[model samples]
Target: MRLVLTGTGASRGMALGRARLEHPSRYLVDERPLEESEVDAEAERLYRAIAIARDELQALREKLHGALAREVAEFIDAHSLMLADRELTSGLFELIRVGRYRASAALKMQRDRLVAVFEAMDDPYLRSRKEDIDHVIGRVQAGLARESSVEERKLAARVGEILVSDTVAPSELVPLAEHGVLGVVLSSGSQVSHSAILARSLHLPMIVAAHQALSHIQDDDLVLIDGERGEIVVHPAAQDLARFRAWQRELAQKGKRLALLRDADTRTLDGTPISLYANAESPADVAQARTLGAAGVGLYRTEFLFLQRKEIPSEDEQFLAYRDLVLGMGGLPVTIRTLDLGADKADASGLVMDDEENPALGVRGVRLTLRHPQILAVQLRAILRASGYGPVRILVPMVSTVEEMTSVRRLLKECARDLRSAGHEIAEHIELGAMIEVPAAAIALGGMIKSLDFVAIGTNDLIQYTLAVDRNNDHLANLYDPLHPAVLKLLAQTIATAQRAKRRVTLCGEMAGDRRYTALLLALGLTDFSMHPGLLLEVRETVNALHREPLRAQATALLRAPTRARIERVVENLKKAVG
Candidate 1:
C-alpha cells in the first residue's frame, strides 16, 4: 500500500531506494549487584571496554581521508574526549569499586547522572548533547558485550538503502555514506543537529523529525524521499519513481554547472561583485576554503583551542595556531573571533564557573573574557603577534555595549605596545570588528559603529535572542525562523547603518550559507557572506544568478511587511521578478 509521510527536510537531495528499518539500539543494562570478590574483575572489564571503544573511534578516524576525514574527525575526536573525561570514567569506576555495583550497572548510573545534568539545562544545544552521552555509552556497552554493534552490522550490510531510524548520530552519517547507504529518515531529530549538518555537507538525502517513519516504513519497502520537501513516499508508485529520476538528472546537471564556477568571479547578473568568505576553525577548513575560492576567512572560531583541555591554552600555543592560520590564508585577510566559550560549550579548562543560573544570559563570549582580563590579555597579545604573519582582523564575540568594544580596543592597544617593546613584528594596521549577535548590540549599532572597523551579524544567536526562541529545541523549531519579519527589520537596520558609516559588515551565520536567503540578504545591502567552506560554491551560484538591483528595490516592502507570510510572499515575487 502506498502512503505519504512528512518530516523536516534537514538536508537537500532526493533518494529512491529500498527502506531499511533500524530499531533503536539502546544498550539496556541488567542491575545485578556485584559481590566484593567480583568488583575488581568487573572494574577490569570496564577498563578494557573503554579502551576498545577508544580504539574503535580511532580506527574509524583512520578509515577516512581528504575532505571526509576533516569533516568527520571532529565528531570522532569529541566522542574520544568524552571517553577520556575523568568525571565520567572516575564516577563509573567509583560505582564499581566502592558501591559494589556491576560494571554495566555503574555505566548506566553514570550515564543517567550526566544525562540529567544536560537535560536540566535551558539551552537547547547543551540539552541536545545528551545524545552524545548516549552514543558514547552505547559504544562502550557494545565493547563490553563483545558483540558486533548494530552500527557495525548495519554499516557492513546496508548498501543502497534509505535508513529509517528514531534518530541518527553525527559519527554515523559519514560512515554510512561511505557504505553506500542511499539516505536517511529519522522519526525524531532537529534540522540543526550535528547529524543534520553533516548529512547536508555530505550531500546525503535526509528527512529528520518524521515521527511516523519507523512505525510505517517496513524493511525492503520501496521508498522515495524528497529531502528538500521533507516528503517521504512509502512504496512509491510509478509516477513518484519517474519524478525522482528526472529530478536526479537535473540535480546532476546543476552540480556539473556549479563545478565550472569554482574558478569564476562572484558577481550578480547585474554585474555587482560580492564577497564570499569561509567560516573556518581548523587547518583543513582553511585548505578547503582556499580550494573553494573563498575570498577570505570571515570567522575563524577560537573556542576549539580552549575545549577538551585540562587547562587554558597558553599564549604561545594560541600564537602558533593563529600564526599558522594567517600564513595558511596566503595573505588573504583572516578574521579571528576571540574566545566565545560558555553556555552550551563545555568549559573543561575550568575557566568558567558552572553554577550560573543561565549561562547563555550570564558571562559568555565578550562577558566571559572581560571578567577574566588576564585571559583576554593573553589572547590579544597572541593575536597581535600573529598579525605579523599576514592580514588579520580581531572580531570580539557577544558585544552588547560600546563599553565592551572600547575596553577591548584599549587592551588591544596595550598588547600591541607590549609586543613592539618585546621586539615582535606586527601588522601596520589590524582591523577590529564586533559580532552583532545580541539584540541590544544590533539596536545600538549607531553608537557602537564608531568603535568598530567592521561588524559580523551572527544571525544564529540574533534570531534566537530576537525571537526568544531556543533554536536547538526541536519543538520550537517552527518559532525560530530566520525570516521572521522582526528579524529582517533588525538585519536591514544593521546593514543600512554599517553601509552609511562606511564600515564593512558580513553575515557569518547559517543564514549566509543557505541559498534561499541569498537574494534576501543581497536586497538588504549585504555584500559580504561567510559560511562553511562546503556551502560557499552553492551560495556563489545563487549570487551569480541574481539581479541585485531588483532585489534591492524590494527592500522597503520586505521590511515594512507586517507578517512573516507577507514577507515570504514578497520575497517569492522578488525572486520571480529577477528570474
Candidate 2:
C-alpha cells in the first residue's frame, strides 16, 4: 500500500511528516477572509453576486426534485422558505447593489455574511454546521466547474487504496469515502476549509499545509502514513510497512465499532444521567445531528451567516438560518452563541489584527465582540427575531466578569426594545448563559452562575489557555493533554462550583464526548455534555449501560489522590467495575 500526503506540493521531491487535523471548523473559517483587492473591484462584485444566486438557484433545483415527490405545496413551501430568507437574499442583493460584486466576489460576500451569523451562535455543534453551508456557498461561488473528468474520478478505482488529486483544490479529498479510497492527503490547502472538515470527519491518515507532496513520489511507490502520529514515510522498508499495516488494522476495528455508539439520553448503573449532545457550527448540521439521534445541539456558531458577503445579514437572513436550525432539531433546543470573532473570523472590513506571536489569545471571540460592540447589536436583533420561531438558548463565550455579562444582557434587552418599537412581538422568553472557559471566569462560576440562567464549560479553550498550550501546534501536541491532572482538577472544580450554586451546567468540549472520562465526569456532577454529533450516541450508550451510583463514589475517592496516574487508575477501575 502507498500514501498521498498533503503538503505544499513543492519541487524538492522529498518532505517530512503529514498534516494532522486541526480544531473543529466551528471555531475557524476554511479560507483566509477575502483579500482586499478581491473585494474592492465593482466588476468582481457583479460577477460574484450573479454566480452565488445562480448557484443557490441550482441547489434549489436539487431540493425541488425531492420536494416534488411530496407535493407541489411542499415544493412551494420550500421555495417560499428560501425566498423569505432575508439574510441570504439580502446578501445576494448587497453583492450586486452595494458591493457590486459578481461570481467569486459575490460568493465571497455571502460567505462573509454567514461568518457574522456564525459569530452570534453559542453552540459548537451549531458552529461546526457552518462547514456544510460553506460547502454549499463555496459550490455556488465556484459555480459548476468539474475539477476532474469522469474518467479522472475513476482513477480512485484503479488504485487498491491510494488517494487522488486534481488541480490545486483538495479535489482528491471528497471521493475517498465513496471511491473505496483508503486515506486522504491533500497536496495544498489553507489551514481552515472544506478540505480540513472532510479530513477530520474521515479521520484520514492525512496532512495539509505542507510542501513537496505531489513531486516527491510516483503513483506506484510504497509509502506509509502514520496519520495518528502525523508522520508520512516514502519508500519505507519492511519494518515501517508492518507497523503501519498493524495500525491500519487496529483503526479499522475502531471504525466498525464507532457506529455502534448511537445518540441517547443514557444513565449509569447507579442511575446518574449523561447529557450527550452534538456540537454543530451551522444550520445544515442540524440534519446530521438528527441522523445521529442527537438529543440537541450544544453549540450553534451563528457567524457563517455573516462572513463572505458584501453586507451584514438582515434579521430575515439571520432568522432563516436560526429558524431552520430550531425547526430542524425536531423540538431539540439549539444553543446559539453570539459572534466570538474579531481576528480569525474577519469580515469584508478584514482582520483587525497585525501579525502576532499568538493570534488565538489576541482579538478573538468575546474579546473581538466587546471592541466592536455595534456588531453585537445587529446579531442580537437577528437572534432575537429568530427566537420567536423555536426553542433557542443564547450563550456568550469568554466572559471574564459580571460586567461583560451585564453589558451583553443590556444589549439583548435593547434588541427586544427595537423589535417592540418596530411593532413586532418578541419571543416569549429566552435562556441566557455564559461559557466557563477562562480560569478567572471558572473561579467566578458561583457568582456568574447565580447571575446567569446557566453555565456551559468550554473545555477546549479552558484547558488550552489555562495550560498555555496551543492545541493547534504540532510541536506542542504532546503537552496539550486534557487528561493532565491539573486540567482535570480545574474541570472538576468548575462543575462543582456550578452545581453548588444550584445552576444548570453543561460541558461542550472535546472532553465531554470522551468514553474514558464518562465515569469520571458523571461522578464529578456533570450531567450535561455537548460534543460532535458523531460521538453523541457512543457516549450515550456508555452512560446508559454503566452504573452511576457506584461510579460517583469511586470518582469522589479518586479525586483525593495526589498523582495523575493514580486518578486515572481509579477512573479505569470505575468503568471496569460498572461493567
Candidate 3:
C-alpha cells in the first residue's frame, strides 16, 4: 500500500529521491561499578574522548571556513565552548571519582541532569539549548565507542539523496547542501528552527515534525517530499508517481518561463514601471540579488551579525561587513535594518533579555534596540560609516509609534555628527525608513509617515499581529491567512495612506514574494517589492503579464469583497485573466 506521511512544511520546494534513513549508532556502555583503581583509567578514557570530539569539531570548523555563512561557523564555535565546559568534563570526572561510576555512566548521568534543567526552562529559546548539549555529548560518546558521528556519515551521503533524520542542526545544513542533498525530512522541528532558516536561504526543500517518518520509512524506499504541502509519499503507487513527475515537469517549465523574464524590466503590460528589490540576510546573498536583477536591497537583516555569538560585535566589525555589502551591490541602495533582534531571533550575545513569557509582544526589534541605546549607537555609527561607500538607507523595524521612528532618526543624526567630529567622511544624506509591521503602526500610518522618508510593510508579522495568530504555532497555522478580510483592509489602508502622502512604500514580506498575491498588491498601488532572490524572476514575470488599470479594478473589487472566499475567488479570476 502507498503510504503518505504528513508534516509541517518548514521550507518551500519539492524533491523526489530514494530514502536514506540516518540512524546514529547507540553504544551500550558497561555500567558495572568501577573499583577505585579502575576509576583513574576510566577518567583518562573519558578525557581522551572529549579531546577527540573537540579536535573533530575544530577540524569541521576549519573545513567550513569561507564555505558557509559566518553565523554557521560561530554556531560550531559555540559547540566547541560546550565541549570545553567544566560542567561536562570536570563534573563528569568528579562523578567517576566520588561515585565510583564507570566513565560512560558518569557522562550519561551528567548529560541527563543538564538536559533536565534545560527542559524545565519556561522559554522555548532557552529550552532549545538542550539540543546543543546533546549534539556535543553525542560526539564524545561516538568518540568513546571509536565510531564516526552520524553527521560525518551524513556528510558522506551521495548527491541528490534524501536524508531522513530525527532532527537536523543548523550547522549541518551547509554541509548537506554542499553534498547536494535533494530534500530533508525531520521528525522534529518548527519554522523558527535554524534548520528551516538555512534550508530556505539555500533554497532546499525541507519537511519537519513528521511524526511517523522514521518508524514507517524504510531504507531505499522511493520518497516524494512536497515542501509546499508538507506531505511525504513513501513508496508511492505508479499512478501517484506519474502525477508527481508531471507536477515536477510543470514546475521546471515554470522556472524556464521565469528565467526568460530575467532581463525584462519590472513593468506592467501597460508600461508602468515598478521597483523590485531582494531581501538579503548576508553579503553572500548580495550576489544572488544582483543576479536576479534587483534594483537594490530592500531589506538587509543586520541582526544576523549579532546572533549565535558570545558578545556584541564591535563597531569596526559591523562597519566592515556593512561596507562590504554596500560596495558589493555596486552602488545599489542597501537598506540596513538595525538589530531587529528579539523574539524568535534571540541572540546569546547577552544583549537580548529572554525573560518575557510572550516575546512577540515584549521588547523586540526597535523596542529592544532603544532599551540598549549604546548598542544602537554603535550600529548607527557603523551604518553611517558604510553609507560613505555607497547609497545606504537605515530602516527601523517594529515601530508602533511615530516617537520610536523619530528617536531613531535623531540617533542617526547624532551618530553622523560623532563620526564627522572624529574626522570620518560620512554621507551628507542617508535615507531613513520605518518598517510597518505592527497593527498599531498600520492604523497610525498617517501620523508615522510624515516623520519617515519611506516605509516597508512587513506583512508576515503584520498579518500575524493583526489576526492575533502566532504564525509558528502549528495549531494556529490554519488561521494565519494573508488574504483574510481584516489583513486586506489593513494593507489597503497602509498603501492608501502612503500614496496619499506621496511617500515611497514597499512590501518587503512573504506576501511580496508569493506570485499569487503579486497582482493583488500591484492593484493596491504597491509599486515596490522586496523578496527572497529565488522569487525575484517569478514575481517580475507576474508583473510583466499584468496591466495596471485592470489590476487596479480587480484590486478594488477584492477590497470590497466581504468574505475570504470571495476575495480568494477574485484573486484566482485575476490570475486566470492575466495568464
Candidate 4:
C-alpha cells in the first residue's frame, strides 16, 4: 500500500531510495545507578568520550573550507566548546562522584537542566539552540558507547539511501552528500534553516516538517520524495512506483530542455524584457545565481551574517563580506537588504530585545534597526564602503510608515557623509529602495515610492501581515492565502504606484519563484523578479512562453474577481493559456 505523507518542501527535486532512519537516541546511555566501586571508572569513561568528541569536531572543521564551511564549522566548534566546558564536563563527573550515578545518567541530567533553561526563554532563536546542545550531547554519548552515529554507519553500508531524521544540522550535510545520500526528510525545519540552504546548494532533494515520517517509516522501505510538492510516499505500490519513475524520467528530460533556455534572454514572445534576479544570503550563492543566468542579486539578505555569532560583526567585517559578494557578482547590481533580524531570526549579539510576548508584531526589521541607531550606522557604513567595489543598492525591510523611511534615509546620508569625510571612495550614486512587505506600506505606496529610488514587493511578509496569520504556525497555515482578493489588490496597487512614480519594482518573494504564479505576476505588470537560483531557468522558460498583451488582459479580469476561488480559477486558466 502506498501511504502518502505531506510536508513543507525546502528544496527542489525528486528521489527514490530505501529508507534509512537516523536514530540519535540510539546513542543515549542507560541512566542506571552506579555502585561506588564503579563510579570512578564511569567518570573516566565520560572524560574520555568528551575528549574523543572534541577531537572529532576539530577534525571535521579542519577538513572543510569556504564561506559556507566556515559557517558550519562555527557551529561544530561551538559543539567542541560544549564538550570542553568545565561546568558540563566537570559537573557530570561531580554528579557521578556524589550521586553514584553512571556517567551517561549524570550527563543526561545536566543536558536536561540546560535545555529547560533554554526552553523557558521567550525567544524562539534561543529556544532553538537546544537542538545544538542535543546534537553535541548525542555525539559525546555515541563516543562513550564506542559507536559511530546511526547515520554514519548506515551511509557506510549503503550509498543511495534516503536519510530520515528528527532534525539535521548544517554541519552534517557535507558528510551526507559525500556519502551519496539520495535525499533528506526531517520532522522539523523551515525553508530558512541552515540544513535546507546547504541541501539546496548541494542540489539534494529535501522535505522538512514531515511530522510523522520518522515514526511511520521503517528501514529499507522504498520511498519516493517529491521535493517540489512536499510529498513523500512510503512503501509505494507497484503501479504508483511505476508512475513516479515515469515522472522522474520526464523531470530529467524537462531539466535538460530547460538548460537549453538558460542562455536565452528573459523576454516574452512579444519581446518584452523582464529583469530576472536572484535572492541570495551568502557570497557563495553568487556562483549558483550566475550559472542560472541571474541579471543580478535583487535581495541579499544581511541577517545571515549576524546569525550564529556571539557578537555584532564589526563594520570592517561586514564591509569585507559585502565587498566579496559584489566582486563575486562580476559587476552585476546587488541590492543588499539591511539586517532583517527579529522574532525567530534574532541574533545572538545581545542587541536584540527577545522578551516580547508576540515577536512577529513587535519591534523588528527597520523598527529594531532604528531603535539601535549605532548598529544601523555601522551597517550603512559597511554597505556604502562595499558600494565602491561595484553597483550596490540599499534596501530597507518591513517599512510601514513614511516616517521610518525618512529616518533611514537621514541615517544613510549621515553615514555616507562621514565615510566621505574619512576619504573613503564610495559609489557616486547608490540607489536606495524600500521593501513593500507591510500592508500599511502597500496602502500608502504613493508616498513610500516618492521617498525611494526603487521598490521590491516582498510577498512572503506581505501576505502574512495582510492576512494576520503566521505562516510558520501549522494551525494558522490554512488561513495564509496568497491569492486572496485583498492581497492581489495590494500587489496591483503597489505595482501601479511604482509604475506611476517611474520607479523600478521587483517581486522578490516565494511567489516570484513559483512557476504557477509566473503568469499572474506577469499579468500584474511585475517585470522584475528575484528568487532562489534553482527556479531561475524554469521561470525564464515561463516568461519566454508568455505574450504580454494576453497576460495583461487576463490579469485585469483576475483583479476584478470577487473571491479567492475566482482569482485562482482565473490564474489557473491563464497559466494553461501561457504554459
The alpha-carbon lDDT assigned to residue 59 of candidate 2 equals: 46
Candidate 1 lDDT at 250 equals 95
Model 1's C-alpha root-mean-square deviation from the true structure amounts to 2.8
Report the lDDT of model 1 for residue 37: 86
The 10-residue segment with the lowest total lDDT in model 3: 65-74
Q: Compared with the true structure, what per-residue lDDT tens digits does model 2 show for residues 67-121?
A: 0111222222222233334666567656545554544545566777687665466
lDDT for model 3 = 0.82
**Model 1 weakest lDDT span, ten residues long:** 65-74
CA deviation > 4 Å runs, candidate 1: 25-28, 31-37, 55-102, 105-126, 149-154, 355-357
Model 1 clashing-pair count:
0
The 10 consecutive residues of candidate 4 with the worst lDDT sum are: 149-158
Give per-residue lDDT, candidate 4, residue 133.
76
| Candidate 2 off by > 4 Å | 1-180, 184-198, 205-265, 354-357, 561-563
Please provide, for model 3 over 458-479, each residue's C-alpha lDDT reduced to its tens digit, 9 standing for 90 to 100. Answer: 9988988898766654445567
The TM-scores, one per candidate, come to: 0.91, 0.65, 0.85, 0.82
Per TM-score, the best of the predicted structures is 1
| Pairs of residues clashing in candidate 4 | none
RMSD of 2: 11.6
**lDDT top scorer:** 1
